[model samples]
Target: MKQRGFSRRSFLQLTAGALGASLLAACGSSEASQPTQTGSGGGGAQPTTASGSPAPAVITGVTLRVVGTGVTLLEPIREQAEKDLGIKLEYDVNDGPAAQQKAATQPQSWDLYDQWFNSVKIVWGSGNAAPIDINRIQEWDKISPMPKEGKLTPEAKEGDGDAPYRILYVQPDNTLGSIPTEQISMLPLTFNVDSFGYRSDLVDEEDVDSWAILFNPKYKGKIGLYSDPSTGLMDLALGAQAAGLATFQNIGNMTREEIDTIMEILIEQKRAGQFRAFWNSFDESVNLMASGEVVVESMWSPAVTALQVRDVPVVYASPKEGYRGWYGGMMLNKNASDKVLDACYEYLNWWLNGWAGAVVARQGYYFCIPENVKRHLSQADWDYWYDGKPAAEDLLDPFGSVVAKAGSVRDGGDLVTRVSNIAVWNSVMDEHQYLVTKWNEFLAS
Candidate 1:
């Protein structure tokens, strides 16, 4: 009755440790803490700017504890916020799901949150998420309509990152809903679609073009998977359809029966020694790719970038079955004190101002406000990242490290070309607890 004694809680307990990883797949510490101090600035909304107009008041002297993955704690963005906005940002960067769990269970653990848009059901379902007034965010109007309407350009309308038009915009009652209201449930940030990557030199380039390559018998024990219950499972679901092992009603929202089929196939593959190891951290993924232990694996964009920098000869694949996509945003904690609530609002506005978006975009993410971020970038960067042109010069990452060679090109091409191919969005699904348990079992097996 319960699908072969796979009790709901049995294996998913493996996720209690949950192998915390950033949404961007950047390397993060087990535990990291940073302090924000007041800088030389006046008491106005636009402290860093020369504008003397009094618009909205930003509170000073309180540290806003943000519970997020390491990508959300990008040092450049953090330092800029402290210097410009006159507010302190102290992030509790951990695994993505752990941040969700904390938001759900411990409502007051942090003042703000940085998470994937898919976690809305879990985070808001926990009733800890508070509404962010649309009026408070200065750049609200500046946000590209791509996030609200799921259209990167005027003609292409399916979506850029997952279901942006679906998950954003909170309802009047402070609940997550589709239609744009004066109050958005969360402030949309950066996102990108993802697919597996492999060592092009190791695998036949001709055979590496489909999701089926992940399950091909020839590469048995040569592949690895990220140990995330959500994205990993969705990728397996897509791979199943591609490999002719199974099908799903909706790969994005898999039913219990669909999940069982996926797990059964995974168990079969496990028995055949198809997997070498499961990656729990971005650094581990880099190690796996660089060392050539696992020739192909489910990979994040940033991980692929990291690998390419090491001269690993890795290429992120464009699967025929399409990509498993994901997006992220920041949310306000409902329990935040009024004293710090305004400060939180200021922080939210800062995210949309373009500096933060520019930082992550260097690692392959696209922001909701591309224009603002473009201001912080060169025409060469905009051309390479958006227009599909070759890089004009060696590209530097946010920290001034050369990550791209001169004349080099971004793999996924222009924004529209990449986002248009998304097959499914990452999701927690209806049976999160049960699937996590089953995932844990698969890992153990």
Candidate 2:
């Protein structure tokens, strides 16, 4: 069953009122839109050199310190941003929990926060993150409706939990709300729907079409799971329900009893040796699958793509129950100096400028401003990734590894088809701290 925060009619009305114009304009063109040179602190500020090459901005004497998980923090991204923005960058990459801890308690440590939309509650509650001024976003109007309207089209399902639009705008009382405003809680960035990946050589493709397969006794001791409480719990609940073990009224916001019941089931499985390992990082997930220790697991897109590069027969499942959607974005720290803030804004605008978006799109992600990403990609690449068509030529990842070969189509089909089937979203539960406590217990068991 699909979960929702509001009725369908109210949702449509709210999104149409808030984001209809921008969505219509964005999808109207397949061509790239030029950056606008309006607003303060680096909106449309990429000046060209006299020789017809892109020139770096004039920001000087500032280094933007960014904190995020390994998913988005890459050496190549740092080098590209430094070259394009004329500023130095330092990345303190951590796993989900550690990154959130630092971001919530250590505001002095980072100028820009790069993480998922679910962590907005902890960081914003800590008062460490500042509201982003949407006026300074050079391509705000070109962003897709997914983050702003909670669905790409009015008829698409509104997935459960904190869909970015629910917490996107800054309200009059300095809280996040659905109403439109000049300031925002996070600057929308890369995002995609998520599901498990399985080895085609070990598991029959037909046998692994549902989340319940993860809990099947046939795969016991060969399965893997993510270690993060927020996402991992959702995966477990999905499997539990699909396996006919238990049902939750709302999987995203489980009650205390529901949490206990799920934890009990997990503990029983752990003691029975039903899992191989719990991965906490992208590299760990890749290594686990590559080394033949994990036949199946909850997976991110890049991990599946990386395995495909090695000729491993891994298939990212398009589960019958639907996908767990997520969004990643940039947030500002409250402790930034005006100079640093300008530099931060410059970096933020650079992310939406197509170059960075194109890089991540290579790894199975869709950018907010898809038109700009289209400019940086070849027609064949765009058709394969966005149109759900077969690859006309070999498609490579950001790091030059071939992920998809000629005649291969993306696993979930087109972008719209993939997102339209979302069953839930990654969320920060009301009982988040309690959930974490129980998750640790399950890990120990």
Candidate 3:
């Protein structure tokens, strides 16, 4: 069940992605309207200062409003950005669903959105979002081509052109949204992977090598599932692929029939009362595992770290099937002034090249600019995080025990394989609605 008192924070910190979504919606005020800036001819448009200077004092003495889902680790980074850029950053945090609802109803209230692929598609399809000007970004060329070149609908290929959104940030894998240019609509934020979290006190390590631990009847009423459909469904698909019922490529290109088959298996498991709880928030999932209410569940890297920090007797498994993952980036809002926009770029560049990536890595999550930050991290740091060994100190709690161990992708141990395959999962999701429906029915049953 969805946890009470778990407020959704903005997903993107530096970008004004998820602000004011809930307040106006609850108040029923339509005061905000989506803002669109006219694109300049040669370079991106520049906003004039009151003094008529070209740049507006380097974003000093200015406040930029950003919105998104919140992460505890990012609070310090937000403060650092404010100090470095000479700008004050105000944030509004909401979850993916709430953010999408607000963006749909009051587009102008939020400057940008840091959400999953489904939410991004909804905003783009509804004409609520503005297209980005990719030309002004300095490192635009560093972005991978999948997100930029992949949006070609046949009609879009004609005069319609690609969708107006520019990717300012991107996860290494383009599962959730496109990679953004320095001036793109979105920017890459952090790199994260998904794994099966289990109670070391209950399940033996050898017996839980595969995804089967989730469906094991012996653990009925002790399993947890994420409330979000996308992650759960992806887990099901990955589990099915691991069990030899399907291949990752097959799951990616799943037909309705294939989805139905997978869904049927999940429904059967659900009917058997396998799930202990369905978690809707990060805290809920972490708490459930920490308190021993759940023995196993699909989980992200950071949350597992959080639990370990609390001295929870849990371990993140490298299942035989492989881990699931996603990447995120920073995006610019069309409504942001040019000065604020430049400050956003400065923050993005510094984040990718500076200590920000290292800070993120310490929390057991990867940063998008892995290459640039390699020298900043130590060999032991690389082994524990990227190489998949457990680090001794818990960056999240500082008192938690080391939890993760290194493994291979084929043996369910690789992180890169998880993030790089999000697009494939998107395609698989399209064909797997029947399966999703079945899974939902199973949950209800």
Candidate 4:
């Protein structure tokens, strides 16, 4: 769903002959686009003039290869990064699991890895990720304390399960911990609170205000679920608890018995046809919802906006239980050359800079350095997106598609309201391998 907000009508508009290509392109998966280089060729740095005029662009003839999902590897970012930093960028975009697997096992393939904080454990454990020196990041201090202290403010509720701060800093013993340190696993960049999206016109809003909606027999054959083991289990766990089906001492780190219990419940639901489909890609989720096949499902911010752009009457729910949270950032590859690392740093700096942040902000992602992101956004944009104020005019996505009509207010209110309400974050459990085997059994059921 990178640039596609295809509705059922839009989906059918394509010729039958072109359906395969169209679907593939809309998915934005590895096959949708190939790895390509962007940026003009050049090399050299310009020193400041005696008159104090701005220095010219520094062109580093380095082609830093980056591996990540379509979430952050959009074309606009690649073009803008190259334009701003004067370094070539080769993006290898993969889906979530593929990207993480490549980052963990193939450090020699990429210079930088752009992924969520939850992935740091596996990538760092693989010894393929290098620690990011906070001293080198220009806006490190300007980032919000949530990624450093586990809370946006002192009073904010810090959710469990691999919170960004928990795996943030690099300890003196070369391990990741929450304690403050000069080095880190990943440089926090974008984050958002997630919840399910429902067809407002089809379902009663009152009946879908909790994660339990996913387990409700009322919507049995119309429910959708993400297929990723990490997030899908978390969402289900939350729902299972909310629905009085199960409980865990630590929802973040469930015991083997707890895993068995949840899997049993899921398998039972699957056998009963409680799920319409399990989608693994953004396009699949959007298609399922926009086609009215699934009335409610776990969804991302961009996916909701995509549905809105298609005029599908979908609503992003502010679940009473709270939202699922995730934060993403840049991690250097351990095998990158010094030159490649330097170029990677330049690209990283450009991400926190105003332009890239604003581009993503339009799609409902909040950058780490709000100050810089604010600079690049207009008053109305900042108010609607960050301040949670009513929109004075229609709001368009980064691709210039109208997503919100005038007077519309963002769901979940402002940034603080959303982040503070996070109930849990995506996680990699201690028994992740065992969990995977059971997850597969449920899928097969």
Candidate 5:
């Protein structure tokens, strides 16, 4: 029997890659885009379940425009939501910088914004992060208190995932407060702790765990790096520090001096042909690895999984310096109408209905509500991805396609085990413009 709010058939049919994806289609796997994966619910009649039950309902005339990147995990679920709830999940996907610009200048372009937490600060600067009342979100109580309270462990602050105090709980006047309140900044979606990945078949496992391997002169010109300043900068910072070229007081919020030092090392590497290519999206990262042009690169988990599934032998490294983490989530547009606001709340609640979380787990992400998501997955599925157990059988993605072979074990172990060890979250520091400028120069150099 299917759950009432989400039918088994109406649930998402797509899977994910590790880390985040751009808001465009770029598949790293050999079968990145199969004809069978084409039932995306962009424009279709409300679908029916095997039992002939009516799909769930939303306000007939209303369509919630969701803005996000082109991540595949959301495809099946987005299709299912439009079919089951009978509302259009219109998307306006964009790359990292373009998406941030959209929030700053085009708040009304979309009713909901789905992006990373780091991007929220930029959106909030433009007054686009509408305060979402906790009362309206059905999952408010069920959300792990860690988000509101702001610390998963004594060392790791809420910044690693949800730092509610930073933006949550706005007053009627829209001024922010530090305490947890009835209103939240955004709905914490999915996140993961990540590090660079390499071709284990090429790089010895003993040389893979440390970040220094990225800057090793031996592999220079055969490495890939992220083009995005935030993620890519952290990777370089870790490499620079690990190689003893430079050390920072706080790499997350690097000072101008620290930035220059980091850039100098990275620029030196770039000029020396240390990097094969710079990737701006997850697909590019996967393609670079699959092409065998670059033997090592910073990567997303899904990319690693994608390569391994193809027998490419990629490994997502758990660096000795610690993981660079990120959280992707949803925020209401500040200028939406009451009707749109209500519809948006329904949509947020719908995510917590468990189906979306299950789809996310397949690609190596940890959902805000894992228990709710666990209900939709098999014991074997959960055991392999979440519990770090060996796959009892071939593990399938949300599309019911084999992603992991039998006897394969997850790389970093369980969700709790991975997230609790995060060293920093993706962030836009005080000197973002300077950092971006340096990043661009490094790429062009």
Candidate 6:
């Protein structure tokens, strides 16, 4: 799901309006329709420069235009890219859906798209994305075969042939997209898995182990849920799996009747007043948890980490059913000038080699690189991180107080059930609208 505040309906409506405008704009046929160049000159692929050469083959004196959400995690990488690549990196911040709309209208203006997996589909469907030359990117070979196929295949219908969507970027070994670029199209950045975040001060351990805890009568009106239908529906599907109502293997092939059955259980849960608030952003989620407005809620790793940073007395728990997760990669804009493109490649290589990975690990998310970075870290860092060793002194927040433990999945008690199968999620997204409507009706009734 696109991590933005707009409702799904609102986003669709906006896209429809934008499409109409784009069609009208096309009729005018102005120079604006063409891509505007924004970087240093350099065209044909050149031979690799040797180390210590006066001028490395590196693209210089260029500005790479990147457009995406202004999430906090990207800042450090952005700064590093500018320094290491010797090029200016420009960012255009847009919420996920908005990014798609902008890209569709001004496809040539931007060079790279940093977005969620689902938003990537919308961007490609709108014909805003450029075809990636797989042969040019050396790291493409590292990607697993399944996601490679997913990027190549378009979104297929119930019985139609495979979809033919072109993958521009992909996270390595991550199923979120196809085509791995060391930096753009697909370079593994971080692995962020989702699990239930609950108030340890309220819910007991035993009661919170299963998906049923979200619907338990005692916690009615004290739970939180994401406003996005995709997340809520996925959680319900996971719960259905736990209830023996469904399984991941069957989830993809489920008939309408099966989907309706899963929807019914979620509807019933909604009718019971389970959700206290439907959070649409990280700030809102943090406020909800910190204020004690919610006892338990579906949460991503970052949010849990944020809460612990504030000493909210919360714990991220992996229920018996498992956790839902996603991994993201950077994609180069097809419109980027050769200079900017080369700079992007340099940044991408640097990120993968361990610097960016270490920073992400500090934020409680896993980086996609191999495990050797641990050797460079101090004992305290390793213990507090990989080993899940609780801090003897309470972790302090900006305001100065004790912090909560947001346990790692690698730790024994926090085992996460993997949920990265794209085929399964695609099927789930197909049924998302119906699920959301049913859930809304349940909330109303």
lDDT of 4 by residue, 1-445 (tens): 0111112232222222122222333343320011112222234443422211112234467788899988788898787666555578899998766677777667778989988887777777777778888776756777889888888977787886878888887877776777788998899999999999999999987787899998898898999998876688899988998999998877777888999999999999989999998887789999999999999999998898788867898889898888899999989987765667667666665565556777788889888878777767888899989999989898887778886778877888999988888889887666666676677688778
State which candidate, 1 or 6, has the greater lDDT. 1
Q: How many pairs collide in each candidate, listed in order?
A: 6, 0, 37, 0, 8, 12
- The predictions' CA RMSDs to the true structure, in order, are 7.0, 8.8, 11.1, 10.5, 10.2, 10.1
Report clash pairs, candidate 4. none
Q: Give me the runs in candidate 6 sitting further than 4 Å from their true place.
A: 1-58, 71-73, 103-105, 131-185, 244-259, 371-379, 387-428, 431-445
List clashing residue pairs in candidate 1: 11-437, 12-436, 12-437, 20-95, 170-185, 221-274
Q: What is the per-residue lDDT of model 5 for residues 1-445, given as tens digits with 9 covering 90 to 100?
A: 1111211122112101111222211222120010110111233344433212223334555788877775522677788766655577787777655565666567778888887777655665566667777776645667665455545555653333223345445544454445556776678877777788888778877778778888898887888988777778888888878888888877777898988989888888888888888786778888899988999898888888888888887878877677887777788898877667766776776676667777878877777767767776789988988888999998887677788889988888876667666666787665766676676677668
lDDT of 4: 0.76
Model 2, residue 379: C-alpha shift (Å): 2.1
lDDT of 6 by residue, 1-445 (tens): 1211212333354345434432332332220011111223245443321111112244667777777665422666667656655677777876544555566567777777764444444454454554444554434454433234432123321111111122334334322233334322334355444667889888888777777677677888998876555555566566667756555544433445666777677666666676687776777788888899998887766687677666677777756654554545555566655566666655455444455555555555554432433543445444565556654343432223333343422322211223222223322233434544564565455
TM-score of 3: 0.67
Give the per-residue lDDT digits (tens) of candidate 2, residues 20-68. 2222222321217656444444454556422112454467668999999
* Poorest stretch of ten by lDDT in candidate 1: 31-40
Error of 1 at 159 (Å): 7.2
Of the candidates numbered 4 and 5, which has the greater TM-score value?
4
Candidate 4 vs. true structure, TM-score:
0.86
lDDT (Cα, tens digit) per residue for candidate 1, span 279-343: 88898889998998999999988789788877888888888777777778888888886758877
Q: How displaced is residue 44 in candidate 1, in Å?
A: 12
- Candidate 3 has an lDDT of 0.51
lDDT of candidate 1 vs native?
A: 0.72
lDDT of each: 0.72, 0.80, 0.51, 0.76, 0.68, 0.52
Q: Pairs clashing in candidate 5?
A: 12-76, 12-77, 17-302, 18-302, 22-70, 23-69, 23-70, 221-274
Top-TM-score structure, candidate number: 2
Off by over 4 Å in 3: 1-57, 116-118, 131-135, 140-185, 244-256, 374-383, 387-428, 431-440
